[model samples]
Target chain A: MAENQKLCPMFEFAFELLGKRWTGLIIRVLLDGPKRFKEISAMIPGMSDKMLTERFKELEAAGILTRNIYPETPVRIEYELTDKGRALKPAMDKVQDWAETWLTPPDQNNGE
Target chain B: MAENQKLCPMFEFAFELLGKRWTGLIIRVLLDGPKRFKEISAMIPGMSDKMLTERFKELEAAGILTRNIYPETPVRIEYELTDKGRALKPAMDKVQDWAETWLTPPDQNNGE
Candidate 1:
């Protein structure tokens, strides 16, 4: 807030994690529940598979989400939020609230 | 959340506005109060003047903030968040809360 008051490095770090393109949308989808790779990809229309895969690895390495592998006849993989990831719900909700309040629907912007 | 449930275009738009590098920090600084250009730039380290100027224009165009010119000997200018920008406080606070809870202090992570 002040020139003398240092910005929290942790807050900066959080942005570094969540503020990238497609990252927030990925988290928003997961907020519903655990999703398979295809499921996650399906919900976000524009994200490339390569970017999604990279984000998955980053979230995994950061301990936000876990990848679970099922040893069925064909292996089934599910991605679920860790405790750390679930803790992000409140923040995500706030963003959603703000978005709903301020942003217009893309389709309705013909007049703009 | 569901694959069938379309992601809100508004949310995507909000992210498009806020998710850029240095944008959040600029908003965070202004959340304290209105500030002159130098004051805002002073608060955020490592941000170039050019980038700050660019973000300021973008924010103004988005109606997130306003630029006020005071007619003095030398024109005094200040940037203030509009109601739209002020509405972002709750969301920013939530992020700050999550960051404090989850992210390690930068200096303490020497072992990592």
Candidate 2:
């Protein structure tokens, strides 16, 4: 395809990847550094293991993240952002800034 | 709340809005100018009326897009980006840029 083709499908695909329930949170957690599966799981409190695995695979396939396995005694596995994934920071930041401006607090908005 | 309260929830919320199946396409369609509902719908060929309605209401509630009603003979309704919605351009651009980089052409990739 040409370089400057219309980006509707691309935007749709990215939205699809980012739109998964815990996908954004997973990327946010990974922003700090490479993380073990357990570490990432711990950071996102309510996500189930099944969902995490699914999102990880989707992200990996999309080339947004990379997974590495070390030849340690116990076999350590870690996930980190690829350059593509890191490039998402600015976009994610814009969303974060908008959310801060518009959304009510969880407690107050939800009356928790 | 503070300007930056970690932002995970906000990111999640924005992702939720952007992630809806037709939501990103809707935003992309709207990029040109304010569009009437039918105009928007025409741009996205496959979407059903009910889904478009749901996404439009959701985007409005999220403070991203605005709806205007004119009391003409036919009662025209139009949708346009709010300042908040306009702010999303950069983020959306990044996703589009990434999609162009990663995704194969629909015809080739899907073997259509």
Candidate 3:
């Protein structure tokens, strides 16, 4: 398994990373634009500060999001999706459409 | 958070379910067509039988796939994606495109 993993490009790794607990929501928030730590946490309703910080680091490592630190009074830090990360937009849009079209209200799912 | 979650459609649940370990592979396997238990298991290189069974049941519950029992010489069970499951094709295609174009071989990621 380990040997074969290298032969492949590791899409599963990307899928699994994004698939992690609150990571999808985190990506969605970033898709709109770059956001500070607190702003990201606010967009996602129940996510914790610890989880948010952890996810940011993890995504940064994965090359999905970039963390930029600004030189200022208090030093502003923001996270933004990279080109690879932005590539996920179409897929995410499809999911949102699926959710709005089929997963909303359960009853509305069969409306089509 | 709970109350707010109810107000919004649960896209996260669907994303999380598909995002689960081996679940994305499972969905991808089913994308071609219905398959028997072993067939689905074969496509995913290292997933455990226990985990595959669990994902199938979970996806079935989520209305992503339907289970059918065929009464022939012996008894056979096959799983196929529902309309909702089929609806995921566009998104999955985007992911696969991203994988092949941007995620493949790492070096070829910047192929564009």
Candidate 4:
């Protein structure tokens, strides 16, 4: 049987990464451009510092984000999307479009 | 500032659902067509029944999947994608395409 006969392993792996909580949001936040750790954290309210740090590390390891460290006395770190990461913008935009069309508020569905 | 000045809430909600474990796979499996519970279970090896059941229920609630039950003596249940769910195929295909291009196997990166 052809390898594509079944579920594509690579697709599954990508989904595995994107499916994680905060991962997609992190990517969305970074879409604007590179941002410092604190800046990204501020955009995602209620996100714990530990979780953000862990997710950033994971994204960096996955090659989705590039982390730059300044050589100054007080080190400055910023995260930016790699080429591969930027390619995901199309998929993310599609999801956003689908959500707006299909997902309505609960109150809108019923008389409240 | 315009409403689009910041992250869209609808996009966040869709990502929240898609980012869950097994949810994407479930959609992938159903892409072919409606399948019986056992059929889907067989296709996705290693998936626990409890987990599948839970995911299916959640998908139905999310309006992504429609469950059909027969009125025969022994009931038969099949799951099919709703219009919204089928609409996600484009996004899913993009993800699969991206995976093939960017997600090279670790072994391929170095001469092992």
* Chain A TM-score relative to the true structure, per candidate: 0.82, 0.87, 0.77, 0.86
DockQ for candidate 2: 0.42
- Point out the worst 10-residue segment of candidate 1 chain B by lDDT: B1-10
Relative to the unseen true structure, what is the Cα RMSD of model 4? 4.2
**Residue A105, candidate 2: C-alpha displacement in angstroms:** 2.4
Q: In DockQ terms, which candidate is top?
A: 2
Q: Give the Å shift of residue B73 in candidate 4.
A: 5.1
**What's the residue-level lDDT of B61 in candidate 4?**
91
Reference interface contacts recovered per candidate: 0.35, 0.58, 0.35, 0.44
By summed lDDT, the worst window of 10 consecutive residues in model 4 chain A runs over A1-10
Q: How many steric overlaps does candidate 1 have?
A: 0
For model 4, what is the error of residue A112's alpha carbon versus the real structure, in angstroms, after optimal superposition? 18
Model 1 TM-score relative to the real fold: 0.79
Each candidate's B-chain TM-score, in sequence, is 0.82, 0.85, 0.77, 0.86
The residue-level lDDT of candidate 4 at A39 comes to 95
Candidate 4 — which pairs collide?
Answer: A19-B19
Give candidate 4's error at residue A27 in angstroms: 1.8
| DockQ each | 0.40, 0.42, 0.34, 0.39
TM-score of 4: 0.76
Candidate 3 CA-lDDT value: 0.74
Q: What is the C-alpha lDDT of each candidate?
A: 0.79, 0.77, 0.74, 0.79
The lDDT, on a scale of 0 to 1, for candidate 2 is 0.77
